[model samples]
Target: PLGMESGAIPDDSITASSYWAIDHESYRGRLNGVGGVGAWAARTNNFDQWLQVFLGMVNHVTGTIIQGRHHHNDQWVTSYKLQYSIDGISWKTYTGNNGSEKVFPGNNDRSTPVTNLLVNHIDARYVRFLPQSWHNWMSMRVEILGCTMNSKFLLKA
Candidate 1:
């Protein structure tokens, strides 16, 4: 849950792109514990166009769920790379054994969401959904599933 009222969405993206079919706030549905009607949209059909959601603190992210626009499939992401960063500017792609950034494929059915479970735990503050390829434009509703930094490790230090 990264985009809910408890979290923050970068304002630079809110009004920066014309491709938004709905407001960016809608991407936080899973954060609110309820699904929302709106989805975040991008202005271009380009690679690497993305949105970032801040959890307000560091977390041990375990997995992620991405739902395409519920009403239709026109602008759904067809493939993407999930990236996380402890500091907003420094990002590391969640990788596979091949050492390349793992590309998670999306569903053609708009209503069915896609998921990515990280190969290893990621201690991060920001997460980004970077589109590799899309049907037309990039749009999604997201849920970042994880928990707060484990205190047991801190105590050990």
Candidate 2:
């Protein structure tokens, strides 16, 4: 997650609303979810400021994915993404940045696994992620490794 706005932040209490402490060593491995889910964070100062979220309804029998370690640029990672949504407000095929992950300098991206996520019938509530921009403020750590599924089991990738 990344943030800066409050008038584009000069330290006006850090804008965009200002909330901190979410870089819990960044999310690395093991994830699962279900319907009506949503994620799109905003935190950090700059070097740690990165964001481009789009998360919602990760359903597919209680959606959960994190197969075999994904995310790089090491150093506790500073960029990350994983997007999906059916009607959370127009969004599809995007695991990270512009869709089709493998980001750098914090551009995050993901998607395209037969529409990345949001099962077949399209009812995805909302799910988003594009955190850690990494500028300097220091605060981003995105990583993943495991997840199975849950939330009504609509298995049909």
How many pairs of residues collide in each model? 0, 46
Candidate 2 residue-wise lDDT, 50-89, digit = tens: 3222122233322222211123212222444444465645
Q: Report the C-alpha displacement of residue 32, candidate 2, in angstroms.
A: 32
For candidate 1, lDDT tens digit of each residue in 1-157? Answer: 4443344544342222234444444343333223343466676667747756666679888888776665534557788888788878888888987888889887575557777787787888877778787766577666777788744553453
Q: Please report the candidate that would top TM-score against the real structure.
A: 1
Per-residue error (Å), model 2, residue 100: 6.3
Model 1 lDDT vs. the true structure?
Answer: 0.64
Choose the strongest candidate by lDDT. Answer: 1
Deviation of model 2 at 14, angstroms: 17
Q: lDDT for every model?
A: 0.64, 0.28
**Given candidate 2, what's the lDDT at residue 120?**
28
